[model samples]
Target chain A: MNNTLATIDTPAALIERSRMQRNIARMQQRMNELGVRFRPHVKTSKCIAVAKAQRDGGAQGITVSTLKEAEQFFAEGFTDILYAVGMAPHRLQHAMDLRRRGCALGILTDGVESARAIVEFGRANGEVFDVLIEVDTDGHRSGIRPEEDALLEVAHVLHDGGMRLGGVMTHAGSSYELDTPEALRAMAEQERSGCVRAAQRLRDAGLSCPVVSVGSTPTALMAEALEGVTEVRAGVYVFFDLVMRNIGVCTEDDIALSVLTTVIGHQADKGWAIVDSGWMAMSRDRGTQKQKRDFGYGQVCSVDGTVLDGYVLSGANQEHGILSREGAPDTGIAARFPIGTRLRILPNHACATGAQFPEYQALSEDGSLETWGRFHGW
Target chain B: MNNTLATIDTPAALIERSRMQRNIARMQQRMNELGVRFRPHVKTSKCIAVAKAQRDGGAQGITVSTLKEAEQFFAEGFTDILYAVGMAPHRLQHAMDLRRRGCALGILTDGVESARAIVEFGRANGEVFDVLIEVDTDGHRSGIRPEEDALLEVAHVLHDGGMRLGGVMTHAGSSYELDTPEALRAMAEQERSGCVRAAQRLRDAGLSCPVVSVGSTPTALMAEALEGVTEVRAGVYVFFDLVMRNIGVCTEDDIALSVLTTVIGHQADKGWAIVDSGWMAMSRDRGTQKQKRDFGYGQVCSVDGTVLDGYVLSGANQEHGILSREGAPDTGIAARFPIGTRLRILPNHACATGAQFPEYQALSEDGSLETWGRFHGW
Candidate 1:
């Protein structure tokens, strides 16, 4: 029996299969055109089936934000995994265990202190761990600057300590703040060059440097060249959201994920139709708040995915979302979105919103739905 | 093999059991003094163990935001439960199923349409559901105004249709925005009076109105009196957070929930020591952003739960949190909180943070930790 939108419970995460596939094809094709290997970040969906779909669409290996993701993906036959975040020393043992269990997991580090710890842990356990130095291209979050002396110091520490200094990687996450294609292209080049420069520095210092990787959803889509990059990684592109749409990366038609909700009640005088999908379902990610367009919580859409021009989820409680018009009070809200009316809400951040649900109802073009399990927590 | 602060994994939700018990005891005692039955909203923890502790602290029944919570709690021996959110007509069968299984699950409605659907479904299924009319005291979110004629019309529909019209309830959620005792006391009284007035109107119209309920964490604590209110409900009190702290209801010491994270790396020049806990672990709830005191993602604390006054998680990525001083860039951050330095972050909202993890590490006074399971999703 197929679970259509009408049969499923309220507050369910819905993934449009056609849109998701089109997104996958789009990203994979972009990476291929730029002549770089594509490592789709599984942290966005955290579902094996979605990762398999990416692999089917020409993505090689995978990138993860946590070791737990590596473990989950490795268990599902994805051996080549890169834990993208800087390495926490305590997790070294778990990384070693995973590698010992036939997983080609690559760990990351950005500073000398962490690089030393990884070397020490590898030496004491007689494990030659693959390590990548995180280079800061945009200075948005973690990483060492491309020209920083510490980059070579850390590279030497890993290369000389019997650990495999695999390469250098950078993510221009600040690209999300830029709406212009020129700015995005510049950020992409900056990301590519900075990581390549860090790799060159390590090589110039007599250390082996093989790989150079860089990406962010916006940059990956806008980059005209990937000159010195060997691979590109991106998440959230699998499910374009309002934030991405506002950045001019994808259209509303390309957004693959949305929260299916039922209008339970209303405050007609205030033009508010209360929905069951609140912060618990859509998450509290206000990523679009400072963007070119601020989607209060999400963009309102019909159950079949047509955008409702003036409607938005203006306010949300823990279990109740207040749907209202953009300006004037739609005094006939009760009649318009009557009790038990099912609707879909496109989120501000696909990654955060997708994490709120335990499973997603993958809606196929044939009007059938299949349950896809998603892993949560560390 | 017990997990302590030294042994357990980073980015884990830690609950100070002693403080939780104190919070539970304080709220229950106040409700007792107010001469009303205490029904703690289990939506805060969503953990059976935590709910059991609340029950042991004199809470008579549990209030839930979703039917799933009703199902989970009812399975754990909590027979008297209230589904506090406005009921969607499609969920009528699920509510009837729970009631048929001997779970005295009370449902809510605010408008005539929902009331008529509830009555029709109840009549068709031969189930007399304990129904509560949601009255609006403050114009914050959902519910019908206390003096609105729809209240009586909806009450008559349920009462005449053979379904049990149990009572009237309202949540003064706007109380969370007030930082003064005087304002909170006034809001509490307004909530109490408004809900009681709705019940009076129903009785004057010759309808049976037995219960009157009203509460919000701030109002529950600052109420000068809850005279007409027969019962009260509150959720965040069990695990006080920074938002509650800013509301002047709970102090920093009263907060029971914190995320245990490890400093994985640093950008010393920027005075940023990156930790393993980010928005993914702490949640994207910027609840305190507009408050008098904005604790950027969360307040940073020592591993022993001692609050670090000037430090807070200033910025966060998916799995990386930037720990820095509130006003100044502490240049010695690398040496101060070096790699592997374990710290705890007090979230802006406890309910949002706790939902990010599958299980919480309940820390006892003796320094031992016990994993308490929590349910997620609808």
Candidate 2:
């Protein structure tokens, strides 16, 4: 079948090939100019096709959220990998298996308990694993307090064991809370300073701390300089979504992935056009909830992929989405949809929506499509 | 390998052979006593194992959300299936293919556009399709207005095109809005009235309406009688979730599935205990958003699988979930979680969350774990 036919024929994730290549190149150039290594997180586009583009665009290594992702990317021939999630005993065997399969795995840990578990697992299994001490930069999520002595204690615990300590890593998660590039830049400084101080503390205590990793799409993209950081791990940059747009990191045009849906029915009296795509297809991730503009779930686009004026997915049921053009004239476009008109919906969080499907139908700038597989589960 | 070890080791979905058997018997007995046929929706578990149980429970047919699901269930010896989503021109070919594969495929369409598309597709493919006229009850989602003459007009288009008019079906999606059993029964009446009225109109027009399907877990369970309804297509009753609990459909103890996550870290002073499971594993479906009590995502349970006192997932990052017990004493319980303590989290929406992961580790009431695989993608 022709690629265009393939794109429209099946229920698949359509990724514009040209847009993705451009997104990868742009991030790579920006990181290169900043003298930092690009460790593009593979969690966004779990497809191997997209990961190779990142590699070709000068990504030295990649970051993964799960061991399954690490193994999948490793099998596709990208080796230098950092399993960015905190290691657990249940996953230790899987981590060791990945390491044994020739993957240079770098696991993250924040507490003494996790450090002790990793030490015990590594010693018992005779697996010498590399570790990154996670530091809490903005106190938004997981990580050890950067100023606390616990950082040194965890480092000592890992060092005394056979594992290698790969410096400190932190995510400026709260940077997403910023509305301006200046705010993002400030959070970036906080992220870098937090990790740098943690690494320095460990080194001053006579511990080897080499790799200082810090990230978040906003912080990484707007940061003035890395300073002491060696690598940046940003995942969402690969496939920017509406949340990224709301944070001022990228515009709507920069979002490369979207959920392709069909306009199925309407309630013209209610000024509502119902689409076949619902939370099941588009995901219920309301990332824009905290943003200046909460596009309910996402922005609605025309069949030919134009952003519809004043159209938004006003509300969504399990398998149905209600579209409304609140401030615009109801030009009977709802009836015009005619049951089979294809529509593309920009997602709130690419990672969440993208994970719902098993693959992406790689679409060219010319609208031709091909299938590229995605990863799911653990 | 023993089924117990297989469940514990594989991250795929598992069905507690016994729990499923009991769930099937209970539903079947309830439906049989109510004098209604059970055409259980296959979209919930989407597993052959579960479908077989439905068949063994004497389900004459099944409802499916997508053609892909129809194909999977059909291949596994299910012949009677309803393609529950509104039919589009694009999917008509797949629907025809399923008919050719010897499955009795029923297509749902509520508009002239879909009616015309199905007619043309069926005419071109020389395949006769059984079609259900979808009726909009309570204006929750897709279906022609029951009070409008459009339902008859759409039915005429399908009948003129050589398609068999099976009957009418409507989902009481607004039944989810009801808080009490009386409210659910009221919505159930609305669902039944809409479909029965539409079917009567078709019959009055000299058209044979052989079936009437009404469904929604709340509506079906609380429904005093089917009355004019011939079959029901409820799925979530098999694996109740937090949303079901909020809707008063099932108690928390009836929830059979949960994500077994490990506590990985914590911010000691902030009272945030990080777990490995996040939206990636738990899904971004906040189905209980409208409920009186909003569990941010899901309810947190102890390692032994009991609901914890006041513990809930307050906030979540991509790979880490923050567990909090508002105003509860530090209890030193968080410390016990330490890095590798396993905890099970009940999902908000079983269908959406279950779809995120490729499989489920079925844990039995007796504490045995088994792996059960689930279908994914279109």
Q: Output the number of the DockQ-best candidate.
A: 1
Model 1 agreement with the true structure over A1-378: per-residue lDDT tens digits: 657999899899999999999999999988889999999999999999999999999999999998889989999999999999999899999999999999999999999999999999999989999999999999899999999989988888998898998999999999988998888888888888888888888888888888898989999999998888899999999999999998889998999999999999998888999999999999999999999888899999999999998899999889999999988999999999999999999999999999999999999999999999999988
- lDDT tens readout by residue for model 1, B1-378: 878999899899999999999999999989989899999999999999999999999998999999889989999999999999999999999999999999999999998999999999998888898999999999999888988889988988998888998999999999988898899889998999999899899889988889898999999999988887889999999999999999899999999999999999999999999999999999999999999999999999999999999999999889999999977799999999999999999999999999999999999999999999999988
Residue-level lDDT of model 2, residues B312-377, one tens digit each, is 877777677888776763556567566666677878888877887777666666767655678887
Error of model 1, residue A351, in angstroms: 0.3
The clash number for model 1 is 0
In model 2 chain A, the worst 10-residue window by lDDT is A3-12
Q: Give candidate 1 misplaced runs (Cα > 4 Å).
A: none
Which 10-residue span in candidate 1 chain A carries the lowest summed lDDT? Answer: A202-211
Q: Give the per-residue lDDT digits (tens) of candidate 2, residues A1-378.
A: 675632465334667677788888888888998999989998988889889888988999999988888989999898899988888766788888888888898999898888999999899989888999999989888888778888888988999997899889998889888889778889999999988998888888998888999998899889999899999999988889889999998888788888788777777667777787778777889889878988877888765567875778878865678877767647686665656677778888888788778888887767677778888777
Give the C-alpha lDDT of model 2. 0.81
Judge the docking of candidate 1 as incorrect, acceptable, medium or high: high
Chain A TM-scores in order:
0.99, 0.96
Following a full C-alpha superposition, what root-mean-square deviation does model 1 have from the true structure? 0.7
Chain B TM, every candidate:
0.99, 0.94
- Model 2 misses residue A212 by how many Å? 0.9
